[model samples]
Target: MSPEAPPDPLDFRPRVALASLSGEADADWARAGSEYAGAAFLGGIALDEPTREAARELVDRDRTEFLPADPVGFVDEQLAALADSPVQAGFNVRTTELEPLHEVGAVCRDRGAILEINAHCRQDEMCAAGAGEVLLRDADRLSELVAAAAETGATVSVKVRAEVPGVDLPAVARRIESAGGDAIHVDAMDSEPVVGDVAAAADLFVIANNEVRDERSVREYLEYGADAVSVGRPSDEPAVLDRVRDATEAWFAGEVEP
Candidate 1:
């Protein structure tokens, strides 16, 4: 069979995504939860030696991690398992080097999946290794990573965290857009209005995340100009997903208000 084109990041039907939760999110989790979401991001997979070691450190601290021997091959395996699901599949990956991003982007490109750069992980181990939240403060390097990922023809998204002191997320959003990124997934933390800031700054598809449990949170994010909303920790709970899905559908259908 021929390879399929990458899924359109801006065209999610339900406008809800199943966010990546470190070690828990995978093809199986995403496939089972696909019915309630328009997109499902799997794996905050560590792609390089430094990040892999950081992941190992996280594991020692009782955190889950995907430490595959062959990072690119692992992505292909995981994405292939989602081939029959209706939800758009994506991989949230961490790497300090540009080569691994390019390699994984190729896999995502061929598999019709989104390649999400991991800039939102706040784990001390990951940050100390210069992989996750470190990228939030280093917009120039993050932009280079996004550009490299985009070069492989995959739809690229940067998963970012809001409210990091000294980091201007809206400014970073513009850089991502200039780097050819197709989407920006923001973990809006306590400051939900940052979603609007990001939306106003760039033409990138904005996916607002954090504390999205029901119609209220869903409506709030959408009202703030987010193109979509993502469910984080509760993503594994079908009940939560159902409520989120309904709210998202309602918002898009004009049945809800701010």
Candidate 2:
């Protein structure tokens, strides 16, 4: 059964966040919504297949963005590097087939910014390891991981592909809530072509990404019920975020609010 959705109350207002698409962690963090005066996300979710041959084949390909060698450590250093910025949210660190997430969780908790557990990645290697979408095949275990991380007092948010029959979006959202996740971040599949626009499933606060980079699109997602929206990639042009931020500011200002 699909999980139940969160209630339609407790509205929030978080500024726009730019998903770090720039290759350099420093550059990505540095850009962290400064121009837009909003929020920033560090590191793109890592889709790096552990095997070398597969890794080479997947670089900069598809919806996946692979990471450099040593993902766990990379997430650590990147977190440290971004310490002083207004930016807080960092992308999900893969823990599917990988081992020992305790140390990783500790690092993120220390930084005061929560780490996202990626259950949405569709890349081949991540899938092969029973990570990402593969985890969707087993919801109970996914709930455990989300709950365990939350126990650390470190926020746990799962990024997932849209709910297929077994994936059951509403049920999963409840598991996430039961697991103590502060929010749910979904990268909607086959979302509308408009930039920054999203197709939200329910009332849960959504941090929707992919194909979002402008004002109107942001409004579309908000209309669909996203608490906040994530921007990146195709919208890398400067001011893409500025326009979005302006629109968001205006909306939240009670002027032209969605």
Candidate 3:
């Protein structure tokens, strides 16, 4: 008999996700914030040796980090913790090698979760280690990683940051689409219109991130063609989520003009 087909990658319920914030986004945090979100991406976990060392250094500097001895096992445990949650779960992971993506992607596939490749982090330690924003400049490598993760049959999303000098986000989005990526989680930073540029460039699901705190911010992103928006720093704030959720619902219901 043939193997079961993978589930649709962009099957989000409410069109809002709790973005992964390094060190802080975990099962418990997800459980607490799941009520107002359709999905939650847990952890910007470091998956390989070099990246782990970089994460350790970040920790030494008082920055939050998730450094698990057994990276794949930690991901499995985190996803397992959210098994009963109503919100769809995902992991935002960083690694310099393709092997770890395959390993972690397999776990995500088994657990029916999204495996988000981290190209958005700009931490000096991470970038110097060639695991984060370095991927942004190397679209070929990023696409290769996305392709590897896609092979696991789990939904794959690439978390990318905008306004990085010389990096063409729309071009990168097209590359991800060709590599079988299901979504583009764009940290729009100060350039909100880039979300629209990416959405127009590829058919992939576009998740706008950064500054998504209220109705105006939510509507702006939706109007710019974002399929959804993710809350980062303020993800744990019930009031903030409430506003974003209501705005999303209102926009979809046509109560608000674009």
Candidate 4:
């Protein structure tokens, strides 16, 4: 008899994820396999800084050490360091150009990592350059970015904010799916039902984010159609991570009600 088929790599749910912790650079990479998080999103990298001065400011504001010089290489190193662990590395990149995103996607493919495009940033600097929330107003542009990243032979995911006023979340999900994006990481922001709507509207993976605290929150999102749930501010505490991990395990075992 033939051996059982392996589970899809991209389909692996990141039950507990480390959402781009901005303050400490070293701590971020070190927490990859901390026996808690199944995935780490190394993030908010400026893909196309206008100048070195701007880059410095971005690094300071985002509280990240990554620079434009070798963003992909940085992600590669992070992935390499977690080689012996079950943790998956995903790079969150901010860029307005399709070509650069395509390049980053290729690098992610080569480095065995996932590439997440940033559409969630609300900072003035990012929006002024049409790199973040601006993409929401232009669905065609957002879809183009997804298509370009997808063309790079890597599993591409778009990170978006669900609370963006006037932005149709389901429409955005459809645009990402139609553009061949592998997943939609929604910063749901207390909108569990909207997550379900997105999942219903699109055929891609859904990673729900925002205010996830315990088993109840995890089960709530999962039942609401989130393939996975992400933790942000609460993850700063080790205890919180522990709780989330246990909750995720129970969730997977069907011990937690959906």
Candidate 5:
């Protein structure tokens, strides 16, 4: 049998997003696997000044083992690879300081890669900086930024958090659609995924993530409306990436929609 075709986001029925952290090994590790169909921009974002320290702190806290001791060069390597890679790359960039987003988005567009704005990182260091949660509060601006990024013609996606604590998700989704984002990567941490509410994809796409610890949860995400679903931490468990890959393939083939 011919090898399974490489993942084409446009043709992908239900996709798997692998979270890529920053570092030589991290990137290499990501490139090491064929099981994961896509990558998430969930690594270091502090490449410039005034906030570099904060970015480092966040990485250290959230991904100590993977993050490098000297992150500036580390991030540069990742950026360089992202610039040079022929295949599509993944990203979960920080919006707290919108410095390098445009240039980065340009690269993604040129490469047909998907670039995501992360409002989903829950690290306390990131949350306190008026980035993830704070940015969520001003859904209007968030939508505008997402739309602006979409101007590049790259598949611009925004990864959002659980949307709890009185956070109105339908309102957020509507505004994101009104803007220009291609999709909202919802980290459905506390609740199951919801498709109808995301119809406002504004001609974009929706990729569900988080709380997908088992086969049943993955099924729920697709049934609920996610064009695709991301599975991470699962890869960290013992021999779990293989399981995730198998489960995702089986689930998509079944194509159970709600």
Candidate 6:
């Protein structure tokens, strides 16, 4: 575990965020607009040619699209286009090594944005390459990855999958926090309570994900101790962002308190 600085409050903890949704390109960015989100994610962007090729091959089957251009340039371009975005911008990347990850982090640092490592990708190609959920199998290496990127002076977040076959999610979350990760985004699936449990076990800001379709689900995850909740499929609809806003404001106003 390495030391870390406190997270930026405006980074959107305990609020509604747009998760990294897959498309031909990063559509979430354009679609999100200035709608009412605390933050928006820009990938699942692959770092190397193999990972990129894997994602491209999986497109028809898994709908995973890696960044078509160089990752550093992609981040730069995305950040350039979002110079005036209202919400915090986070770039989600999938890579197995620290060098490329560091490069991407450097881009984030130079551009003044957040870099989120994608350990939550479940695609067969990603898993087969030991680049995604496989990181959960080795906490030390995962922590090292987090630590390495954090050293680049970039805000780092580790996104992991909950309910994995042999992965102890709470332990993973703690390790990420110890490694200086600023946030943990959990694809909690149907087990909402795990979000709270992870929050309790680790000091990192927890972002709950999975099946977040409506206001009810958003409120449920927040009540479960997640500092924030992310929506993917539901976020595709502009009206859904309104619902999330209503639900979040209501939560703060005590109308959605459980």
* Candidate numbers, best TM-score first, in rank order: 3, 1, 6, 4, 5, 2
Write one digit per residue (lDDT tens) for candidate 2, span 1-258.
999854221232345665554243333544545566344555544433443334354564643354567766776777776666555545565564333355566766776665577677567765676666777778787877777676665655677666344566666777777767766676776653221222233334467666666778777666666667777664455667677777777767778845
- lDDT digits (tens) for residues 1-258 of candidate 6: 888955473356337777876553263463463477778777778887767777777785857475566777877787777767666777888777778888988888776777888888788887777678888988888999899889988888888888888888999998998898889999997677889889899888888888776788878888888877777766667777777777876887788648
Per-candidate TM-scores read 0.96, 0.76, 0.96, 0.87, 0.77, 0.90
lDDT-better candidate, 4 vs 6: 6
Poorest 10 consecutive residues by lDDT, candidate 4: 21-30
Backbone clashes in each candidate structure, one number apiece?
0, 6, 0, 0, 6, 1
Looking at model 1, residue 44 earns an lDDT score of 90
Query: How does candidate 4 fare on TM-score?
Result: 0.87
Worst 10 residues of 6 by lDDT: 24-33
**Cand. 6 Cα-lDDT:** 0.78
lDDT by residue (1-258, candidate 3, tens digit) is 999976564777688999999999999998898889989999999999889999999999999988878989999999999999888999999998988889999999999999999998899999999988889899889888999999988899999999999999999999999999999999999999999999999999999999999998999999999999999999999999999988998888889977
The Cα local distance difference test for each model comes to 0.92, 0.59, 0.92, 0.75, 0.60, 0.78
Instruction: Report the CA-based lDDT of candidate 2 relative to the real structure.
Output: 0.59
In model 3, the Cα lDDT at residue 231 comes to 96
Query: By TM-score, how accurate is candidate 6?
Result: 0.90
- Which candidate would rank higher by TM-score, 2 or 5? 5
